[model samples]
Target: MSERAYGEELMSEKILFVDDDINILQAYKRQLRKQFDLHTAQGPEEALKLIADHHNFAVVVSDFSMPGMNGVEFLSEVKKISPNSVRIMLTGFANATNAINAVNEGNIFRFLAKPCAPEQLALSLHASIDQYHLITAEKELLEKTLSGSIKVMSQILSLVNPVAFSSTSRIKSYIKHMVETLNLPGKWRYELAAMLCELGYVTLPPETTSKILANQPLSSNEQTLFDAHPTVSASMLDHIPRLEEVAEMVRRQQSNFSDYTLTEESILADPSTLGGCMLKVALDFDRLINTGMSLPKAIQSMSNRRGVYYPRLLQCMESLSKVDRSMEIRPIYMKDLTVGMIADEDILTVNHMLLIAKGQEVNLPMLERLRSFAKTTHIIEPCRMRIP
Candidate 1:
């Protein structure tokens, strides 16, 4: 593999080396450039930008001492930016304390001393790449294969109880936006949790699902059933391999801010807690809007409920709502409905039976179902929708 600067096309190596010293970077290029595909960055800031643009790297090697940010700090940032990338620290002054800190805080895969032979560095790089492959392959299996099966099951369940799963797609979108807006790492876990958050709804009767979705006051018995959904969902997820963390997030979705003393700064450091808080915010926001509350009013209502939501997450939702409201809402006939359009109001049949809930994203199956219904039953025309 040829030695190239950042922003070049990725080759088989997918390896990055960051150091403040040009001499050291050049030396790496001179010695190990042929053995592996090499990319170089002068400092941590540049390396981070490169990772942001390029998306992923199999392995990242950084010098321990540098201007502004040290190796541990840089590697920590790398963990956020490219989590699948295996990190290694190579420095001239490696102490026991530094090693311990690097392992704990930075979560580095390996530590190497300076003046290391090319053969040793190459071996380390090979191991790091192998680790990267393991991480990504397992994620692929879960996301593609396992997640696909679960979604199909949810879709079938949605058919049985449309009211329960009506908001699943919308809730997933909300969580995805928050993850990006808040710059939270390990987004897949939260997104997968969002997808399966309503799995337990399948266990509820249609009447109970309707009450929960409508934000109606449930009876004591119904409320008990409602409260157990998160646990039921979490239990099901817990049985799956590599889903322990996602299960925990679903398990804690209904937890309140008063339950813990996490500050805004500290909350960012804990993804599991943050994931659960995000789920709560998304779920509650959806319920409020479904009750005919405006964007600002829904956010304000959530904020008024002290100790119920994480303050910063609510703020993020408010900001996202402003952006979402920019889309133009237009009236369209049933035939004009296409995929990805957001429903502005509940769609009902001629008999006043609810057909599609508000805030649901239009999908192909829904379109086909609507078409099939139009042939047999009369659906109210001129649906109010937000078209992008």
Candidate 2:
């Protein structure tokens, strides 16, 4: 194959063409079949069904003069169904009103007049595919870079505010367990939100965090500051690319489900909001556990506050506690440290300085840092860590 043909083949080949006329659809298939993997639908309804069945179309080209739904309206729905797909409008009459609607309402990438040349249509389709690739590539890049930066920020917070960061780790573990038990989607976002949910505490006085976590009475001003941490954390993260959903989850993390009646079905309907509720429960449970309450007592205490937590969530916690109780801790040499392992106790040097805190989740960066520290100073062998 020629280089250009090879490139087109490698690009997004999936395309959808919607028109009420069978002849036009036939012509599209005849001309574009060799260059793209095409799907045709007689009308907007059929097009919607096709979209529902196959969700990964990279481009959707719709005829403007349809029976029930116009191309603009159909494309608007297409945007909701698959925002990354490039949209194009084909109309018999090229009017200013239709063109404006196509651009403004549908966010169409191209507006082509009917009876367009085969070559022109092919070019437009290729360009649309290119646009889709560009959009998805940028989105992937933004998500990865933003996620890494947040992870590093959380690691720094762990060092700076050990008390608050330690609580974050524990909550994160609980959320991981809960999400897995529920088999929910977007587990990464939930975990990330849990890790950084308490980031705002870095701005507050350490004493304030200590008092809040300990359930000690705080002065009016201190209580106000504590209440503002979620909003502060959200604001700090809102501008980072692709973190809007995570930021919103953090912003609502402190909400009480008691304010409104929400069933498991309703909460599960929106995973992001469900994540916020999960963070709330996990944080509260951790706070109770840290304040000298036993595991069973902590669960009982949160369970007693009926509307404060989603019942389904508390049930997941109960399940997690059983699994946690059955797990055993063992000593593993520092050289054998692996990611995802939790330190059962603090790893300290002969001089009694803290190396890694108890309950800190082992990760690559932590492992590398420990290895480097071992080079300069001595770390006791056979470190104790917990595993499930």
Each model's lDDT comes to: 0.84, 0.82
After the best TM-score superposition of candidate 2, give how far the Cα of residue 340 lies from its true spot, in angstroms: 3.2
- Tens-place lDDT digits, model 1, residues 1-388: 4446321433475789999999999999998877678899999999998997776678899999999999999999999867889999999998999999999988999999997999999889878877887898888876787677766776665555567778887788889989888776567788888988888988888899888988999999999999999999999989788688889999989999777788877887777788889899999998887777888988999899999999988888877744334469999998888988877777888998776777666777777877788889999988998886
Model 2 off-target regions past 4 Å? 1-13, 20-31, 40-42, 45-55, 167-191, 203-226, 239-244, 258-275, 281-328, 350-352, 372-381
Clashing residue pairs, backbone N/CA/C < 3 A, model 1: none
Q: lDDT of candidate 1?
A: 0.84
Candidate 1: regions farther than 4 A off: 1-58, 62-83, 87-114, 117-138, 321-332, 343-355, 376-388
- Candidate 2 lDDT over residue span 1-388, tens digit each: 7978767664546899999999999999998787788889999999998886566789999999999999999999999767888999999999999999999999999999988999999999878888888997987787677677878888776765555665666787899999888876457788889988988988789688768877789999998998999999999989976678888889989898875566667777576678788988998887776666777788899989877888888888887644332347889887778887777667877677666766577767778877887778888767888776
**Superposition TM-score, candidate 1 onto the true structure:** 0.73
